[model samples]
Target chain A: MRLKCPANFRIVRLPCTGKIDVIHILRAFEKGADGVYVVGCMEGDCHFKSGNFRARKRVEQAAKILDKIGVGGERVKMFNLSSGEGPLFAQYSIEMDKKIKELGPNPVKVALQAKKKAA
Target chain B: MIIASKKPIEEIIQEVKDYKRLLILGCNECVTVCEAGGKKEVEVLASALRMHFIKEGNEKKIDEKTLERQCDHEYLEEIRGIVDNYDAILSLACGVGVQFTAEKYHSTPLIPGVNTCFLGANEQRGMWTERCQACGSCILARTGGICPISRCAKRVMNGPCGGSSKGKCEINKELDCAWQLIVDRLRDLGRLDDYEIVAPIKDWSTERAGGPRKVVREDVQV
Candidate 1:
C-alpha cells in the first residue's frame, strides 16, 4: 500500500506545536499518514513557558490511544526543535522517513495476510 | 457534539482475538472533542493492548493511526494502502465511523473502539450532557434553544408528561423536566402563546427510519 503523501512531509506551523491540538494529530493518522511527529520548542525555549511541555504530553497521550486501538502508537511522536534549526528539522524528518521505511507500507492499505508478511 | 466513551481495553482486545496484527484508527471529529478517541486516548488504549499481549507471551503487531474525520471518505483514503498491512481495524470513532470504515474497507473486519453514546453538548471543560434527541424533527428554535425531546424522559412533545415534580423528570428525579424549562423560558420571554399551539406528531419514518438517509446536492454532486 502506498503511504499517503509519501513524497511530501508537511510542516504545519502553529503559534506553538502545543497549539497543535490532539485532534489534529489524530486527524493526520486518519488521513493515512504512515507516521506523524509533532515538533515543539526546545526545553525552556518556548515563547509560552510550558507550551512545549503541554504539546509533548498531548502527543504522548495521542500515541498511547493509537496503540490501544491496535494501531502502533510508535507512529505518532513528539520532538523539540528550536527556531532557525533547519538542519535539525531536516534530520528529524529524515529520521522519521527512515523509521517509517523500517515500519514498511502501512497495513491499512494491504490485506490482512499481506500485513503479516510486511510485519 | 455527541458524547461517547472509549470501550474497555480488554473488551476491545477480545474483539480482535483472532487477529495477529491490528490497526487502531482514531477519529479526529466528535470523538476528539469528547476526549474519548482522540490521539491521547488512542495512545492509552494502545499501551493497554500492548501490555495485555505482552502478558500472554504472544507477540502481536499493532499499528496506530488517527484520521481527520472518520465519517469522510477523503480522510479514509489515507489508510487505503496502509490498512492492507493490518489484520483488523479497531476504530476509536463513534458507531458511524466504525460503519464507515467497514464500508470503505470491505475486506477488513472493522471493530468499534468506543461506545456511541447520546447526542450531547459539552457542559464545561471535561464535562458533557445530553441535549438534543433529533426526534426526526426539531423544536429547539421554538423552545428558546432547549430541547424537550432530550430533556423530557418520555420525549413529550405536547408538554410535561404530568410526571414532573419540582421541575425534575419523574422518570428520574435527578433529571430536569424539559417542558418545565420550556415553559419557564417562554413565560420569561412573554411568548407564552407559543406554548399553546399543539405540535403535530412527528413522522419518525420520514426521518431516519426511511432507511439510511441521503442527499444529493446539484451544487456539489457531479
Candidate 2:
C-alpha cells in the first residue's frame, strides 16, 4: 500500500473536485507550478451528485484556456478514481510528473524569472 | 437579454497589442447572465493576457473592472477617475455597452472583447437561443407568443413554408420550424381558425429599414 510518488509535486486539498475553478488551475501556473492535475471522485461516485462531472468540465475549460494562451494544455489533466485507489493515485502522480518534466518549466514561470532578473 | 460570446484570444490580443496599459472591462448585465463578459470572465481574460504578454517578453500593465452596467452613463462615470490611467480599454460588454461606454469616454479607444450575438434567452447553462430581433413590431399575440421574424429562417408571415417539413426548418435540421410551433400553439388554444387570416404586407419602415430608431419618453425624462 506504501508507494513513493514524485517528490516534486504539491497537493492542494479541496472538499470536492467540483470546488476547483478554472482560475484556481490558472493561478497554479501563474505561481510557477510546472503542471497541475485534478483527481476527482470516480465518475458518478461523487458524494455531491454531479460534482465530479462539474470538475471534469472545469478542468477541460482550464486546459483549453492554457492552450489558447500558448501554454500547452497537456500540462493540465483530470483523473477520476475512487477514494480507495491509493496505488492508482500514486501512479497517476508519477505519470503527470514525467509528462510535466518532459514539457519543461512553465513558460510563465520562466518569463517571471527573467522579469525579476531584469529588475 | 442580449447574448454574446467571447472573441478568440488571438483576435483580442491583436486589437490591444499596441497599447501598454490596458483595462479589461466587463459588464454585469446581460453579458454576465450569458457568461460572456462578466466579472469572472474579466479575471480569466486578464490572466490570459498577462501570460501572453509575459511570454512575449513585453509584459504590459493589465487591469480588470466590471461595471454594474456599461450601457448607462452612471456606470460609465464610475470609471472616470481611473479612465486616464489606461492607454486603451478592452470592453467585454455587448456592442451596445461598448458603444455607450465609448460615447461617454471620447478619447480612449474602446475595443470589443466579445461579439454581441443577439437578443436571446438562455436555454440552459452555456446555451442561448435568439428570441427577438427588435424589429419594432409586436405580433406575438397573433402568433401565440412565438416570434416568426426572429425564429423563422425566412421570416414568413403566415407560414409552414415549402422549406418546413416534419416541424423542422430546411435551413437547419436542428432548428424547429417557427410556423409549425405557431400552428401547434394556435391549435392547442382552439384558435386554428385565426391561421386562415392572411397577413398584410409588413411595415418594413418600422424595422431597421427605418435606420437607427430611437424612442423618446417625455414622461420619463427628468
The reply for model 1, stretches above 4 Å from the true place, is A1-119
Q: Rate the local accuracy (lDDT) of all candidates.
A: 0.78, 0.93
TM-score for candidate 1, residues paired by index = 0.65
Write model 2 residue lDDT over B46-113, tens digit each, in one string.
98888888888888999999999998988899999999999999999999999998899999999999
Estimate, for each residue in A1-119, the C-alpha lDDT of model 2 and write its tens digit: 77999889888999999898898988888788889999999898899999999999998998998998898799999999998999999999999999999999999989989989989
| Interface RMSD of candidate number 2 | 0.9
Q: Is the docking of candidate 1 incorrect, acceptable, medium or high quality?
A: incorrect
Error of 2 at B55 (Å): 0.8
Candidate 1's displacement at residue B183, Å, is 0.6
